[model samples]
Target chain A: MPGQTTASLPRVAITTGEPAGIGPELTLMLAMQAATLPAQVVAIGDPDLLSSRARSLALDIDIVPCRPGDDLPAPQAGRLSVWPVSLRAPSLAGTLDPANGAYVLDTLDLAIAACRHGQASAMVTAPLHKGAIIDGGHPGFTGHTEYLRDACGVDEVVMMLATDQALHGVAHGDTSCPLRVALATTHLPLRDVADALTAERLERILRVLDGDLKRHFGIVSPRILVCGLNPHAGEGGHLGREEIEVIEPTLNRLRTEGLDLTGPLPADTLFTPRHLATADAVLAMYHDQGLPVLKYAGFGRGANITLGLPLVRTSVDHGTALDLAGKGTADPGSLRVAVSLAADMARHGQ
Target chain B: MSQAQPCIALTLGDPAGIGPELVAKLLEQRDVVGKANIVVVGDRWVWEEGQRVAGIHHEIPEISSLAEARDQTGPVLLPTSTIKPEDVEYARINGLCGTSVLEVLKLCMDGASAGQVDAICFAPLNKLSMKQGGLKHEDELHFFVDHLKVETPVCEFNTLGNLWTSRISSHIPLAEAASHVTSERILSATQLIHDALIAAGIEQPRIGVAALNPHAGEGGTCGREEIDIIAPAIDACRDAGYAAQGPFPADTIFRRARDGEFDGVVTMYHDQGQIALKLMGFERGVTVQGGLPIPITTPAHGTAFDIAGKGRANVEAMRHAFDIACRMGRHHASR
Candidate 1:
């Protein structure tokens, strides 16, 4: 429907994360709706686990076991091409086992390798259980972004969440543009958010946000709206000094280098349609400031994209939903969007 | 005028700001005039300037005192102080204008104390102007607390449509927000909003408290504020018989509230609730001064100095402020 013939469709590799969680069923659900998707999706997990989950969910897809770079059949419903990896321990739905933790990491490593070797155009990931991975003996397991950064040997990557659902009439300068929010700092205490924002860090984050919008999103010169660390953007130092000391200085230096950046504006007013309508992306100073609004605007329908990466990777904006795993009611909306976004980014590269 | 109508004292917030023009736009609406016995309290010349900026005029009768305005319905002007139209500097903060704004609000507060007014809905005020106008307190709420001699807890409740939010710490440094997340403050904010929502006609409001840390501290790996501070305060709220839930992660809690999961949310700091509420509806948000003896409300927006005297301020927030004041005033009147 989007002018892609079946042979020319880009290949998207999806990892079934945290086998005990809803990742397997969500993957199977995505495969069943392959005709509506923009790319050829290959589920990179244990073929047996997907088959079991598919049976439980009553899906009628044929789980064809294939390898990376295999000549897969044309896109069709009820036909899933799986680059099979064996599970170290059999996984049960709705039950987390640390024994299968390495299995989860194995799936990710395989997807990364495949994408690196040109076997897949891009990779989309479902949610993984951090606790299981940590307990299964990788003590420094922080998150998927950190894992990918380390696996790829990159110094840093920006976590940006976006949704095709238009926030307002003029959101992102168009009625149909997606709202993208990238954080300068992630997963620190509220008290530590200020200390984490140095001039160097802000410069690097802004550069990455700007560069990736051009390289990945196809925006030639991205206009990013930045948020200040303090309330009312420090209200000209009556509220706080971060805007004066750190944010403004960094933005001024970058602006002279020809970056189209605005604000040190108030976070409360920055997310409004008046300002958001003019941004390609927003760089919030911390996690809570930008995310709460983005999630509220596009929860359950958003995709989490990792910028500054050597390869294009997108993930669902939600979690594994361990409670609703076996119940077959977990929504595949985010995974579908993630795969669709990854497909778009792959096409952009081409 | 009908005795059934409650008297509302409306002040032109900061003469330099767009408050006067917004109040002037609000007065042109016939339905707002018919709902309450509206008394416009400010300098007569400034009120006329608002009318001129708004490009509208009304023959509001002049009242010499609050006692005269108490019995009259429709829009009545009580010129407590004088500022000439030529002396008014639009969009520039002046001590004289600030002092005049404080005096006008003080008169209304005194009238409210004397039972001469049921509610007070003022236009947006400039904090720096008020401070330059000789305000000793950090903000107007503190000034009101001192003036009204309120010994109990007080917080500002921001409402968008049906969802209400109150914060424990506001107008402080982000670094210091964690230090203010004590159990005592959270309970105080919860109690205040719970009572205020009831007074505003919500029966048994369910309040959702936000976690102070990210992912609710991820079970104390990231920060201890959620475990050590926020949860205990939420427990205290439950024991106190208020329908309260969560120390939910700040990011997703607002979505739940927006989707009708809760009637209100009590946040640990300002931007946690503000970033969500303003994004949800910036033009329709109203700020209600909670735990006050008399009902007080204002537009949650500030004095838009960039567009002051442009005669194009959106009057929806101002109108909602008036409607809330009238609603709360009616409840206060019946009680």
Candidate 2:
């Protein structure tokens, strides 16, 4: 029934990541299997790279090109509608060139602009190579989430990695399952993490994550579990005072707001099957604290979603596999999942 | 006489705190006595009070010397005071009780230095109470280090299957911590951990040194501490036949350590290793003072003053500390 419903399908924009990496190959693979997706998709990147990748993979698809100021056309079944952003040279597969860095930025800029201007409802991005971008003379962003934050002119954003409820699902009750996981402090240095952590920061991230879980995933009052920064949550300040002075007080304040939240539990044993079974989402302290387990749990199929942004944005959790680019053997599992998630979020958006 | 079994002179830290109760709970385990003889150094009255609280009627063997400890069947008690048990209150600092803790430590260290005890495993000592008791040192470890005056780069290490060693000086200001991180200090810390791990039977151990800067200086964009100091020290260690690597991003090095990519890590400051090691396995982790004349181990934790004497203190860390001390003692003896 969900798949048969075509009238509610949304228009999604996808940014093909670094031209020389697996982004082009994977984008082509997803286009070849586009009929299975729940929305019409438009790709923003060089058209030549997409065609060559599709041909190399032995997959055929129609390519519709658009120019600036041209009226957007409806996507055709078994075809990909691409708005070509001209590049200085042809994007070669598996070869990173600083000359094409501007092209990558242009593709993302156009895709995000479309989403902001109401031309597209949601956006899915492929991974970008940081080294190449830096070499291109653009102040290289920390990552896509931060770049999106600055590009869209938003203040805060949280990074979440989600997998299918079927494979990584925890039984909530007699008849319920949902996707989960949110990070509090994302991509920070070890020393700066403690100072960056605060009651307000954690409460804001959790509140945003809780709202998204309900709006996008159709789960109400999601049960959120928070992990502590120190060992055993500071063992009542015997190990460290941050837990008593910061984390516990924040949890209490958030709990008073009538949200179903719990813990500041020991980080080591918090990921057991029984604990995750009842939790709709787990809030980790930093990148390594949470991503390792989430990536391990989902492997290459995890989709990373950015919360607190005005528009829906999601991406494949895996980085751009430059070594596997152009071989036509790169996996499209995570990219496909990212596109599906973006579509789902778009359908449930305000 | 039967060979003197490797004995751990366990100091009952802060008599007014939970140290006494935790020691009592630890001694109740049969496996503890099976491992090594535990000689509790503290006030005799505190031990009696601990027994009453734990509801176990066990005789206290008052031994005058380590030679007399060889014949004792249960935990030998080396009493340090004549104060009555009723005079001390739970979770409250008293000058007499605090002084007794320091005295016991000194006696235990003297015994350990004389080779009367193979290792020393201690409970958590309250620094505030020690200061209140007129002790003229920052901490018990500093006092011990200064008293021995036989230093070859003694550093504190916390182990939970994965090991974390500190390179920079601890308990100072953050600005001072950064200043103290020199190539010589980093090289010495790495060598200490590498040699300690190899002595613990880890062959060709891989050691990871976390950077002092974010993104490992990000090519001098952040701070040049990693490039200027940390990397050169790592190179020095490698040239000396040590398999040392990193100045890796501090954000992810601990995860690499957890994944078995490195045998041990030399963190730049206190909380870097403390946070990661504690998060990995707090209950099972043990703190070892590496490069000491005598191998010293304790729980990777402190005095839980809030729940002191509440009969809920977990003894897992303490038990692990004793186990490591005995194992390291045996390794040292064999060598």
Leading candidate by DockQ: 1
Classified by CAPRI criteria, candidate 2 counts as incorrect
Share of reference contacts found in each model: 0.85, 0.07
In candidate 1, position B81 carries an lDDT of: 66
Best by TM-score: 1
Task: Give lDDT tens digits, candidate 1, residues A45-93.
Answer: 9998888888888999899999896888888888889988888888888
**Model 1 spans with C-alpha error above 4 angstroms:** A168-177, A298-300, B1-3, B80-89, B93-96, B333-335
What does the interface RMSD come to for each candidate? 0.9, 6.0
- What is candidate 2's DockQ? 0.10
Candidate 1 total steric clashes: 0
Q: Go through the candidates in order and give the C-alpha RMSD of each one to the true structure.
A: 2.1, 5.7
lDDT tens readout by residue for model 2, A1-350: 25465445777788888988998778777877776777777788878778777787777877778753454454444588888987766777778888887888888889888888878889899989888887887765566788889987877788888765422444345222244568888655444666778878887888788888778766678788888776445544544667788888888887898778878875655655546677878888765556655443422256889988878999987778888888878888888888888887787784
Q: Candidate 2 clashing pairs? A: none
> How much is the lDDT of residue A228 in candidate 1?
82
TM-score of each: 0.95, 0.76
